[model samples]
Structure formats: C-alpha cells, structure tokens
Target: MKNQTKWKISTLISLICLIIPFSIYSLWIYVFNLGTTQAERVSVFKDYFPDFLDGRWSTTIFSIIFSISAVILSSINLKHLKKIWKLINIIILILSGILLFLNLFSMM
Candidate 1:
C-alpha cells in the first residue's frame, strides 16, 4: 500500500482506539455517578466502588498509547492532512493523560 494509505488507515484505527474507550468510560462514569467533581465522585464511590474502576485507568492509558502511536504514524506520512491529524492526536493524548492523572490523584 502507499504511504498515504497506510497513514490514513493507521490514523483511523488509532483514532478509533482512542475514542471508543473514552466514550465507554464516559458512559460508565455517568452510570456510576463518577462524572462530576473529583471530590464528589470520590465521596460517592468511597462506600462501594467496583473493581472495574481500576481498569478504567488502564484503558485510558492504552488509549493514550494508541493516540501517541497514531501521531507517530501520521507524522511519517503527513503529506495531505498535515497539521490537523497531528494536532488532534496530540490534544487527545494530553487530555486523556490529564484525566487519568486527575482520577488517580483524586483518591488521595
């Protein structure tokens, strides 16, 4: 396949990998009352938080990794889209990392 085709495919896959989990996580947090302020969420979940919450952090990390990979792949063959894909992937990566960090530190 051509480099452009490879970049497009990898970018699409990585973008999906980044989005799908966060979508599911948002839904999960909504359902579990963890969508609001960190203090509020912590208070609510402190009594009976499920084991799966821990895994959500792992999922977010994986999503960040995928986004980073996509950025790298996109960087290699950025002949068409140029800055758009790279900017988007970078934003997603940073936001996901911030969210993960906040969630982890909120417990302390």
Candidate 2:
C-alpha cells in the first residue's frame, strides 16, 4: 500500500517534468506565430536573451536542461515501479533522449 503510493507519487512527478518543458516551448511558438511580423517575434525573445545567444541556442539549452532533469527523475523511480509503469518510464526516457537529440542537431 505504502509502496504503491510512493510509486504513484513518483510517477506523477515524472509526468509533470516530462510535460512542462515541451508545453512551455509550444507556448512560445504559439505566441511567436501570432506576432504580426517576424521582427516582433525575434525582438520578444531577443529582449531576454544575451547578445551571444539566439532562439535556437536558447531553445536547445532549455530542452537539454529539462530533459536531463526528467531523465534523472524517471530513472530514480524506474526500478520501483510496476511492469506497466516501468514501460512508461522507459518511454519517457526515450522521448527525452529524442528531444535532446533533435535540439542538438538543430544547433549544428
């Protein structure tokens, strides 16, 4: 009972970490597209970015940071989870890896 509760809590935490970064990125994209001009979108992100950093780099950095965090959290709980939950954790890890890969590739 207690063990199951712990797994549930960890699973919920893992799910939140998995979703939040991508949700924030998607929101950024939505807002960017809604702008009247490309300059408007660029200016908005540029205002907060350092002179040396641009949108792609900032996005890749954010993705790597958040995905690594999700990977760590999912791995910590993985062994204690049930079979179906184990599969879910594996999927999350894989997706996070893919996210990191694509982001890094874009930086090239």
Candidate 3:
C-alpha cells in the first residue's frame, strides 16, 4: 500500500515536470509568436525578457533539463504503477524523451 502511494506521487510529479516544457513551448510559439526567422524569435525573447541569458537558448536549456528530470522521475516507479497509471507514465516518458531531443537539436 505504501509503495503504491509513493509510486502514485512520483507519477504525478513526473506528469507535472513533463507538462512544464510543453507549456513553455506552446506559449512561446502561440502567445509570443516564435517568429518566422531565427533573428525575429531572438528579438521576441529579448523584447519580452531581456534579463534572461540568451533568452531563447536559456529556455531551451531549461526545457532540456526539465525533460531529463521528467524522464528520470517517470522511470523510477514504472514497475509499481497501476495499469492506467503505468500507461500514462510510459507516454510521459516517451514525450519527455522527444522533448529532450527536440531541445538538443534546436541548440545545434
């Protein structure tokens, strides 16, 4: 019972971590209009948040870090999760991996 509860909690945390990068990317592309050109996107970030160090790259780096963390958290309790939760965690893990790859690729 206790182990199940712990796995549930970890699954929830993993979900939240997975959501963060997606939300940030969505906001950047939709709300902020991640512009058509690289220079335009950089300008948008600069205009909105000048304090960030290389705003676009900084966000990408943060997303990579969060996605890595999510992958770790999601993997921790995979064997202990209930059927539905296990499925969800697996999806989250896959998405986190995709996000990690996308972020890394964008940096190149």
Best by TM-score: 3
Name the better of 1 and 2 by lDDT.
2
On TM-score, the stronger of 1 and 2 is 2
- Badly placed stretches (over 4 Å) of model 1 are 33-81, 102-108
Off by over 4 Å in 3: 31-38, 46-56
lDDT of 2 by residue, 1-108 (tens): 899778768877777777866665666677688678878876775665466657556756866787787788788778888888888888887877776676677668
**Which model is ahead, 1 or 3, in terms of TM-score?**
3
lDDT of each: 0.54, 0.73, 0.82
Supply the TM-score for candidate 2: 0.65
lDDT by residue (1-108, candidate 3, tens digit) is 988988899998998899988876776776356588867776775565447546447878888888999999999868788799999899999999998998888788
Q: How well is each residue in 82-102 modelled by candidate 1, as lDDT tens digits?
A: 567667656655654554454
User: Which ten contiguous residues of candidate 1 have the minimum total lDDT?
Assistant: 45-54
**How many residue pairs clash per model?**
0, 0, 0
List the pairs of residues colliding in candidate 2: none
